[model samples]
Target: MEHRIRLAGPAEAAPELACLRVIARLPSHWSVEILECGTGYAILGLRTRVPAEEAVARIDEAIAVLPLLGWRRD
Candidate 1:
């Protein structure tokens, strides 16, 4: 299955850089990639074999720390 997280409003960095930073903080076991990026938002694609609900929960938990980095879900 594939899940997506949209990160927006990167404070001092380009969208790609901000996404990279977020990816770096996520668990290495996760299969994550940058799907799309623009001036203020980046879309991260996560590919996993887990169930849908669990995948959502995992992604949510992973992104919980994004607010501290000046990014918010869009």
Candidate 2:
């Protein structure tokens, strides 16, 4: 098997950038927890020979931040 790597700037990452925005205007007193929010990035820094447990933990953490997982717009 083989793989390829690609790089992109914020503009290329978001075509019609303004249209794809998801705003989470949380209240002042409540907690502000969101995954795809500003400057709150999740880096799954997995090396070539890392342990499964470590990778799983990192992935879980990233998944936990996603607010749309249990949400529906229908």
Candidate 3:
């Protein structure tokens, strides 16, 4: 199954990219894709055999620490 998190605008992309990089390296049985949705929007695609809720929880955990990395949405 695949789950995606769509983030709008360039403002969120940098940190999201950074965070997602870590997510991509995490110990998971999932595959991650970074997709450019448009001029300013992006998508974080997660393909996993895990449950949907588990994927969401992992994504949420990554987002939760985003601010600590010095990136915040404008």
Best by TM-score: 1
Candidate 3, poorest ten consecutive residues by summed lDDT: 65-74
Q: Where does candidate 1 clash, by residue pair?
A: none
| Per-model TM against the reference | 0.69, 0.27, 0.59
Residue 48 of model 1 has an lDDT of 76
Question: Model 3's lDDT to the true fold?
Answer: 0.58
| lDDT (Cα, 0-100) at 49 in candidate 1 | 78
Candidate with the larger TM-score of 1 and 2:
1
Candidate 1's residue-wise lDDT over 19-57, tens digit each? 777777666887999999987788999887777677656
Candidate 3 has a TM-score of 0.59
lDDT at 36, model 1? 95
Residue-by-residue lDDT tens digits, candidate 2, 10-61 = 4223312211222222113322222231222222122334355543443344
> Residue 22 deviation, candidate 1, in Å?
0.9
Error of 3 at 35 (Å): 1.4
TM-score for model 1? 0.69
Candidate 3 Cα deviation (angstroms), residue 19:
5.0
lDDT of 2: 0.27
Local error of candidate 3 at 43, Å?
0.6
Model 2 stretches astray by more than 4 angstroms = 1-47, 71-74
